[model samples]
Target: MTTAPVILDRAAIDAMIGVIEGRGHRVVGPVVRSGAVVLGDLSSTADLPVGISDEQTPGRYRLTARDDEALFGYVVGPSSAKPFLHATGVPVWQGERTADGSFATRKPEAPTPVAFIGIRPCDLAAIGIQDKVFLNGYRDGVYGDRREGVFSVVVNCVEPGGTCFCTSMGTGPRASKGYDIAVTEVIDDEEHWFLAEPGSDAGQEVLAQLGAAPASDDERVRVENLLVDAADRMGRGLDTEGLPEAIKASMESPRWDEIAKRCMACANCTLVCPTCFCATVEDETDLAGLEAQRVRRWDSCFNEEFSYIHGGSLRPSTYARYRQWLTHKLSTWVDQFGEMGCVGCGRCITWCPVGIDITVEAAALAAAAKEATHV
Candidate 1:
C-alpha cells in the first residue's frame, strides 16, 4: 500500500510533532547547542536549528547563520542517531547474593518507543550497516530492541558538508530507504516547505493524522533541483571500485606507518563513527560485596587492551591498531557483514585531533598499487 507524497509546510511541522508525541514516543531531532548542531529531545519545531547551517572539513567544524530559517539547514554533526539506537553504555545485568551465596542476575528494562526526525542519508546508510552487525545471526538483544521501536524520519541532504563523501560511497545526497518517512526541504526567497513520502505503515499513520495535501507539481520540481544542487556542492569522494581487495593488498604498504606518525591512538574516530560497534564489558561490586552489576561500554580497537589475549596483545604497535581499524572498516567488514562499514559521513575525519581522512588514505594506497603495476 502506497501513501501519496505530501507537502509539509511550516504548519505541518507542529502537526507531525503532535502526532508522534501523542503516541507516547520521545521525539529526537537536530538542535543547536554548545556551538554545534546536535541531536536533542524536541518539544516543538522551535528546537530545530533555524537560520543556521554548519561548515565541515577535515579537522574542522563551525556553525554559520543562514539568511533563511530552513529547519534542517546543517549537515551532520559529531554524533548521529546511532548512539541512541545502539547505546554507548548500557547496564547488561545486576547480580545479587542468593541464599547459597551464588549470584542471581537480572537484566535491564526494555526500551521505550522513539521517533527520530532530521536524520541524514549517510547516517541512514550507517544505521543499515549496524543492522547487519547487531541484528543478524547471533543477535545483540539490547541494540535490537532499541532499534525496533524507532519511528525514523529521514531528511535528504540539501547541503553536504566539505568532508562528506556519501556520493562516492553511493549512500547519499538523499536517503532512499530505511526510514518510516523521508523529507526533502525546498526553500526560496519567498517560501519554505518540505516534500515528504511515507516509507512504512507507521509513516502512513502519522501522515493520516496530519491531513496534509498531495505535493503540487511545482513543489516536486523544487525538490528535484534542491537535490541536484546538493550533489554539485559535495566536496569529497572515495573511489570504492576494487576498494576491499586494494585495502587488503595494501597491508604491507608504508601508509600505515605514516598514519601512525600522526594518529595519537586516542580512539576518537571509532567513538564518533556511526557504524563502529566495538564494545567492552565490566563488572562492578559495592563495598559490601553483596551486589554487583555488569555494564557494556563502547570500546575501540585503538585501545591496547582491545587486542589483548592470554599472554600478549595482537596489535601491540600504534601502526598495527590503525591498520586494523581502517582495514576492518573498509575491507574485512565487507567480508564479515556483506556491506561496507563506512557510509562516508566523514566524522572520523573531522573529529580526529590530527584530521586523517579515510578516503585520502584508501585512494593513496590504491594509486600506489596501480603505479607499481605500471612500473
Candidate 2:
C-alpha cells in the first residue's frame, strides 16, 4: 500500500503533542540537561533540545550548541532505550497486615503507558536486538507488559556521531521499520519541518489527528539524501567476516593481556549499551524482618562476581573478563543468536573508562588472523 508522506511543521508537531498527551500518556523525549541531551518527561515541542550537538569519545563526552536550532541535534547520551522498557527504582511492594504478627506482601505496581518521542534509528535497532533476548526467547512478562502500552516515534539522523558506525552494522542513518512513526527533520532557508511516515495503525491514527498533507517527490529525495550523507559520515566500521570463528580461535591470544593492562574493569560500557541484557534479582526485607520484596536490577559482566561458578569466579583475571565481553558481543553472540549482538550504536566506545573500542579490537583480531593464515 502507498501512502503520501506528510510535512509536519512546528505547529503540526504541537498539534501532535496535544493528540498524544490528550490520550493520557506522558511523553518522554530529549531535553537539554547539564549541557547534554537527556531523555526525560516533556510537555511541549519547545521542551526539546533544538540547537545542540554532542561530542562523544571513549571515556569522555561533551555537548555543544549548533549554528541553527535543530531539535534532534545530538546523537545519544549515557541513557539507552532500556529504561523506557524496563523501569528503574519502581516500587514493587507496600506494607500489608499479616495474620500472625508480621507484614504481608503487596502486589507490584504496573508501569504506566509511555510515548517515546525522538528516538534515533540506531537506538530503535538496539531495542529490536533486545527484543530477541527478552521477548523472543523467554518472553519476559514485565517487558511484554511495558512494551504493549508503549509507542515509538523514531527520528532519522541527519549527521552521524564521530564514534557511530551504524551504517557498517546495517542498522541505521535511516529507519526502515520498528517505530510506530518515523520522522526526518528537514531544514532549508525558508522552512524547518519534519517528514513523517506512519509505520503502524497507531501511527496512522496519530497522523490523522496531526492534519498533514502529502509530501512532494523533492521532499522525499531530500530525506533520502540526508540519510545517505549521514551514512557516509560514519567514523568507525568493523570487519565481521568470520568474526566468531576468529574470536574463538584467538581465545588464548596475547591481545587479552594487552587489553587488560589498559582496562580498568569499570562497568561503564555495559551500562550504556542498549542491547546488554544482563540483570540480577535481589530480595530485601525491612528492619523489622516482617515485610520483604524482590527486585530486578541491571547487572554488568565487568563485575568479578558475574562469572562466579561453583568454586569461584570463572573469569578471575581482568584479561579473561575483557576477552569474554568482547568475544561475546562481537563473535559468540551471533553463534548463540542468529543476529549480531551489537547494533553499532558506539555506546561502548564512548563510555569505556579506558577508551577501549570494540571495532578496533575486532579489526586487530582480523589482522592477526590474516597474518597467521599467511604463516
lDDT of each: 0.87, 0.82
- Which pairs in model 2 have colliding backbones? 50-70
Indicate the TM-score of model 1. 0.97
RMSD of each: 1.2, 1.9
* Candidate maximizing lDDT: 1
Error of 2 at 63 (Å): 0.7
For every model shown, what is its TM-score relative to the native structure?
A: 0.97, 0.94
Segments in model 2 whose C-alpha atoms lie over 4 Å from true places: 89-97, 101-106
- Name the lDDT value of residue 309 in candidate 2: 88
Model 2 whole-model lDDT (C-alpha atoms) = 0.82
Deviating ranges (above 4 Å) for candidate 1: none
